[model samples]
Target: MVKRFGRTSFTLSIAFAAVLSAAGAAVALPQLSNGWPYAPTPQHTDRTYTLAAVGDIACEPDTTENAGNPAQLKCGSASLGGMPAEFATARQADAMHPDLVALLGDEQYEVGKLNDFEQSFEQAWGGLKMMERPSPGNHEYYAYTKHGDNEAAQNGAGYFGYFNGHDQNGTPYPQGQAGNDTSDEQGWYSYDIGNWHVISLNAECRSAAFGNDCSTTGNGVLARETQWLAQDLHADHAACTVAYWHQPTFSATTSTADAPDPAAPGAGSPEGTAAQAWWKLLYNAHASLVLNGHEHVYARFRPMDPNGHFDPKNGIPQITVGTGGEDLDTVATSGGSYTNPNLVTAQDQAFGVMNLQLKPNGYTWDYRPVQAGPGFGSTALSYHDSGSGTCRG
Candidate 1:
């Protein structure tokens, strides 16, 4: 694998299963020989499929919500500042023909309005919608509170509406889209792809005000989801397992991307206890990998145990791939941001996609950046990271 480093400075730029559902179905994705601006010819592997993953995508300039009220606005151009990166990564994934696309979260920008998904995200990623297995992000939940746009989201109404088979405007959900028909509302589910049990989680607990704890005994929305997660893990016996969501339990950056109010006193605290609770369960179960977004950058930690200690022999690896198509954030060289103290690799430059080549007994991961261009704008497109690991779940 090629390694690119030393140019730390750069401008920021950049699915699912049914509730307790089994995977016997196949999704037919659009075929594209070569279309992306900087498309990379994916390496061909016989019987070794790939799962493409990235998050924090799609930017829309429109401010009107379904209620005809103005919505919360973020800094994004008509191109969303990350649209090119989004399309480029989508094109690359399409060309690679990944068996599944795991969207960590924040598929739509600035409050995740339903129209935004249609006008911006769907337009670029429609080709892979059917193959997308997604988790909800803070944007999806922001509408519930004033933090989003002061527009009533009815607790992520637009998000659940769209993924549960309808647009917020009541349009039908695209056919063959990921997520179980019954549990799309919660945005959590599990399915198997070639002996790997993949769980898509809803980690916007604070945004949803679910609870501080992710235990089944807790009486909150997060508890319910965690309970479901436990049950899902108990029921499935896959040798390799991966769970993904928004908001990482461990962060390499010091900034808070999902903060409810960064200006609030103590608002920027580390903010991963809830996720840590989920991690406890996963650790006990020997989960192989945990993927997340919401950091606006890419960071991969070494396999870590429940206590956030390195344990490559028996711990799960957590990867934050928040660079799907949004402005980037810097990795922490000090303690100002939430410093995890052990980041195996990280980058704040160039938009890219992580390809997880899933094999029967192990998997290989490659985070390939888009080719250098005005789109990347000297954001270190040469940054590349790859590794292979055996299944521990």
Candidate 2:
């Protein structure tokens, strides 16, 4: 006899039936033709993987700004009361034991010098270095002036050296990981993780040391990167794809406010606008998602086409998780109201990491904020968001 049970009671009924069958009882189970009891075919389980991502991390060790003030937006601010905010987030990522860690960008503060990374970022996230797939941010190329004017700009030297290992002949920069910025390579690569094809692009092509032109028509780093991306997508055979970089084409923060204003759309960064070509390529390839940092907040956008129109069946969702211990920024406001119709949800008050559970044909994301220590008196401890989506394939 075939029996149907309510969702809540189905598990119990299955257990009872299995027990009766194991005891060799004369229970009338679902049967096929002839005299044999029917057996259900086992379902195939898809291999799944996990990735932890975040950026805008690691305060400069020498920064004295807000030395012990956890509430202030400065390098020395602490999280969980006593721990450095960056370290707290690192610990959170470590606990997840993810298969991969995507360092969105700006892994180190100031100019991302090798020493700064060694002194600050390495102290916290070093354990995950081997598994990290990194992309360079503007800070890695050109940032605050510690040496003199633009002289302090390591031009991706520090970033590549730290990730790809320093050169043996005393050359400051290395040529692996994201590749040297001084060359046409410009650091764009793709790899497969489980059933997903992951691409990491460098969006800081506008840096003076690289190629100042990010325009689609310019024959610069951006152009070369886009050409490489087109080829990469053409060669990809994965059912699902995700691309990540430093800047975002769709920002969660507006110009007026630090957070997204419901009254208006986000004013995306110029670098992001330059990446529209990338969006077009990925969209044509039916990419599933885009991950980004640099906005210093966590924001999730509804799936949208390259033109920024909602396209549930064909659009790609972009998740910006820049809350990697750097000070968070408020969403931009228009007329004192939050707008940005494309923005689904955003949080700027917390330092956290985003955990992505990647499946064969779909994925789920969970944004977990660092727990505040006793008497921390912060709202970050309460912020959380999670959702699942199917692959466009």
Candidate 3:
């Protein structure tokens, strides 16, 4: 059901007595039927609609004080990146009234802790007055991977807690119930929007092991998401599929040179991690788009197969808009799997977001940097790169 709530328009300052009176502070979050993730149901708002997708924000406060240990960088907080700044970026995205804002992944950096999310949601991206469908990043699995802890065993309990608690009114999501099994894996979920069928798969997995072996599992290229993709794709031929995750299977940035090992944790090369698996499933099914971050830069590519081969016959176009004002990385000049001749556009040194116009034909992406605002000192003209195949409205 569609609903609306009210909040203080003006930032309020609590009086002395108000501080102590705040003892019983409580908020009601959304109540999910099975207590997983959800949205406010897509309301018909005319046929013309706009949607936005971004992730790998790794938003953190200005100071590094709250950062987790350096070892957990894969899943820990990036205290270096300011959360408030990125919040402003999201605010701009809100101005467009995107029909549905798909959170690509790595929404919070480091350990995907609730505290970091609190700072981010309340300060940044809070301008959006609706629901957000988020995908899980490798950072979301930090606690579990780093220490093999049970706290996150239940689908990132702490991360869920942060989202549930941060919700202002009874948002109806958590419904006060907490998760208990990482095995539950609600983070890798899916939903529909407009003429699109979207999926958020976890990127940390190679074949995405259910337990210890890949034989009985389907995490990465495994049968789990693969099977899901088949059903969802077969369910609707016209419905475009858009998939997102924390890291891109293909990143030409210097930072991702040490891509994780798919065969063995810490042993796999960056050459073919989850991208290989993703390519097989998405390319064959002809998914319209794929999104990624972790590169700290903005880039979009022409439709291509898993081996970085340009295959217009059936390929998934990808966008790396990890440039949500987090620290930027330099572009790499490496060749082979990391270098694809089919690159439509690439600006490794810039920080910006890429927007796609999902029309009836092949799509077109416009890369707009966040700095174009105030400090940009008056800049105009957005960047555009037309990919292969027909992606027009």
Candidate 4:
């Protein structure tokens, strides 16, 4: 049994109140099955869709270097009492029967070598690969190990090969579904689901494998991506749109100045900062939402503009669902108070997958923590956060 909440009505009431107050009219709202009043917008359609999203999943494969480390050994370890958290989340996501699975990135841990993805992530998430729309994370483009010390991995070659399909002749990099990362082609694309348009972007523009720069001024990889995005958005006519990648421009977790262990890589970090350009494009286009990972925690922020100020009417809300497994991180806090004011809610103690129900004119999100069996230890798997939001017209 999945948990449901009345927060959807609370959110809708706030939004509708502002609209109704401006119009100065007393219009009766139609009630939906979820108890929220429905107002049909331009994006209205009879059909609805569900998406399961998360990232930073799958542990490092058990190798000579990863042998004794419990973090790397827990991918599918039955000794941990029950199914590993990643596997549990996978099962939870499978149960939803989502129309699509958006993998925010870092699907494979450590260096994301093809062998590791095969040994670990494949066992846990391969079942959903057919419907998955994946993006690359920092781990996928790392030429060195996860510690940033050794150089034993291919830069995104493994990632490209896995999702894009490998060649029978045994090539280091295969170009197919994910596009050619080693060349000028890049790996950003968009598609439609019902009335919504979804985009998957590559955030590893600063990686040496790309152009080592995310500036949109020159003919760099990210610059081209920006150009493509502008064109993509300009051509899109969807009433609601969403763009997703790994890092976020407005992170929910801050540094030690605000919290203990920083779950995110700081909203001021280069990648996060560079992402503002993308946000500007999306915001200007009236995008509905932005999904991201790389934080190792679950956080949802109030709708805000590209500059990070609250903009409930036209701004885009960002949801960080990085809690797909791989040891969770602590949310930033000072004396038990959250650091980021825009953060609506955050949980760091449990691994979970976010189920997004995309309606015609709006959407509802549910963060379902993975339920652990008897052997899964004392993880707080009962934590939940859910709400609904209307799309910008």
Candidate 5:
């Protein structure tokens, strides 16, 4: 209700599913309570909430995989893209009165190498680097082609070394603190933010690549991540719930047969058979929304149950947020636009990040696309919706 026209921040107790997640130093979040550094609070009383999703923050890849090797690296294999833009996005989010960030995936380009931890992601998102409630994407898996063909390095390493993805509270995943029974680095995790509890899944399923998993050990990380997703979702009834990953479970963009070089659809394009089960899991749980990338363009799916169940009573909204610094992929449609009943809105022109204002009613999703030429930064795309809890009972 607050009609402030500038940046701001607020102080509120952020939380989760029947448990207390770790809390920050009680530092006042910018833009959520007070006016932005540029704007002063007006002597008026009003009610409001603001959250922004700064589209995609990543490097522009030359090939499909985009991850460059040490031999001939491009995009610096940076963790995230557009440092200044990311900073702006964070500031914009902070200023917009955000309770927490949604953290859409593909955090790092190329491989999930150790170097990117500092260079790519940390450098780009800045303070955002502190709280990473991440879902593992194909790229996050650091997946690599065993064949090692010409552009092999671009796919990144499917190494699956060791990772401990935390929730917004900064605690280890699966509800236990460092116990061997359920303790190990993993791709999927969950956390609670504000009145909502969220799960970050590792949808970058690459079990088929290795005899077991890409790792020298036959530990199937993809399966582990999937199991965790189910448990995470069932653990609570937060006012609202959502999940973030790297690949769109459903995107209108198709893999065009006639495109440039390796970027072609036949070989590798992102969406695979990995997420079918997870898709169903989401439908049953009725997650409020799902965020993903890897298609190079932005697309939003209509609210429907998984497998086209089309349960108007409770369907999740799926969105594709792939337009960061990466080049747009050839426009193709998995189905129709928003009018088609089966599919929602679809377009090739949209290229930017998403800005969201998370509220009790729902989070407002704004697609801000970048313009042609240079220095334009980002433009406001006229499309967004509220997905507070289509699945809430």
Candidate 6:
């Protein structure tokens, strides 16, 4: 069922109240059925629909250093503790009335505590919570990794608590209700929107186990998720398909240098190699598109095959839209700075959202930068990029 919102606007005051409600105060969240992770009911007739996608959002105000900072809870300022980019993107997405919202990952910054998501993320995007189809990010599971042992933590309990909380019977999913074991391990699943088949996967392998590569690791959640992807793709007959996860298989920026054994937990480093295993599955299935978050910028690469070779006729295009609300990262300026030769468009300064108009045989994308507005920083109004492509399948 579609949810109704009585209030038509979001302000700092409302965000503060949301924080209090998250803390033990009585406040009812929007009603979501047991089938919280859902897709639009498939239609046989040819049609089109739009969805907003982005990630790396919501900053936590109550850091260890600022735990008792009263002013931080005010939610008045966009920069100090408040997430200006999150509010801007959420508000813009709400106005667009897209069929759904695809939150790539990093929904909450700096450890993804349940309270942080409620206060910061829900405060801005709560009105559309049920419309969210999300994948877990490094923030959600990094605490479970060796690199993030000391900082804020949750072991992903909070992330799952918010998304996979209750079923229609009011039974909590964490108790093994409905056999939904994917709740904690690797929240991977596939669904259909129009003629499109979409898959969301968990790529933060370090979160599940220490010293594990997300792409090539042969056991545990990564292995199971890879097996599941193969089965899901073989079963689906959609003409157009897209797969999304936290990290990108190909990043155009120099930020991702390969880590030397549990290196620092930073955004840009040589990473995403583990995702190559997943890429091969999608490629063999003739997938149409791939989406990711983590680079903290907006980048669109040319159509390429599973091995990162240009193959516009049968390869998949990947877009990194990690500029939701968190700080941005610079794209490599010099040629040969990155591995992927198909780097088409990349920008790091503006905060924005990527809109995809999915058709039966292809899709069109529009990256709309959120201009200066309440809770948003000053930025010129313009689209970073816009184009359409036919489905390779």
Candidate whose TM-score is highest: 4
- Predicted structure with the largest lDDT when compared to the true one: 4
Q: Which ten residues in a row have the lowest lDDT in candidate 3?
A: 7-16
Mind giving the per-residue lDDT tens digits that candidate 5 earns over 1-393? 122232222211222223111111112111111001122222211233344443345443344343433322345333223444344444544454543455555555445443453454555454543233344445554444432423223122221221233455533343221111121334344544445555655454452332234221123555444444454555556666676766655544544342222221112423433564566666666667777776666676667565544556677777776665433553463343232244455444444556654455356676655432122223434434333332262
Clashes of 6: 8
Residue 389, model 3, lDDT: 38
**Candidate 1, run of 10 with poorest lDDT:** 5-14
Model 4: pairs clashing at backbone N, Cα or C within 3 Å: none
Give per-model CA RMSD.
11.1, 16.5, 12.7, 11.2, 11.3, 11.4
Q: Which model, 1 or 3, shows the larger lDDT? A: 1
**By descending lDDT, how would the candidates be arranged?**
4, 2, 6, 1, 3, 5
Question: What TM-score does candidate 6 get on C-alpha atoms?
Answer: 0.77
lDDT of 2 by residue, 266-340 (tens): 245667877777888888888999999998888998888766777888888989998887566666545654456
lDDT agreement with native, every candidate: 0.63, 0.69, 0.49, 0.71, 0.44, 0.65
Candidate 3, residues 283-307, lDDT tens digits: the string is: 6666888887766667676677766
Q: Predicted candidate 3: what Cα RMSD to the true structure?
A: 12.7
Error of 6 at 233 (Å): 0.4
Looking at model 6, the pairs that clash are 215-274, 255-268, 255-269, 256-269, 256-270, 257-269, 257-270, 258-270
User: Which runs of model 3 end up more than 4 angstroms from their true locations?
Assistant: 1-46, 62-81, 143-155, 164-182, 206-223, 254-272, 334-338, 360-362, 372-393
- Which regions of candidate 6 fall more than 4 Å away from where they truly are? 1-44, 63-81, 144-150, 166-172, 175-184, 209-217, 255-271, 335-340, 372-380
The 10 consecutive residues of candidate 6 with the worst lDDT sum are 10-19
| C-alpha lDDT of residue 371 in model 4 | 50
Question: Model 6, range 1-393, lDDT digits (tens) per residue?
Answer: 234322111110111111111112333222212222332343643878777899887776554553544443324444432466678888888877777678898888667766677777887777777667788788877752332234545546557666667565533365221113343245666657777887777777775432355544344556545655665666667788888888887766653344222112222433376677677778878998999998777899888776677886887888999878766666765445443446787777677889998888889999978843334345545546999988766
List candidate 1 stretches off by more than 4 Å: 1-46, 63-80, 144-154, 167-185, 207-216, 255-271, 335-339, 371-376
- Expressed as tens digits, the lDDT of each residue in 1-393 for candidate 4 is 222211111101111111111113333222211111233223225578888899988877766655644542445454322137678888888888887788998888767878788888888788887667788898888654343345454568778878876777645443444544545546676766767877888888767766688785455767656665666666667778888999877776676664343333235467777788788888888999999998878999988887778888888999999888776666777677677777889987778899999888889999978854323445577778999988774
Flag the better candidate by lDDT, 3 or 6. Answer: 6
**1 or 4, greater by TM-score:** 4
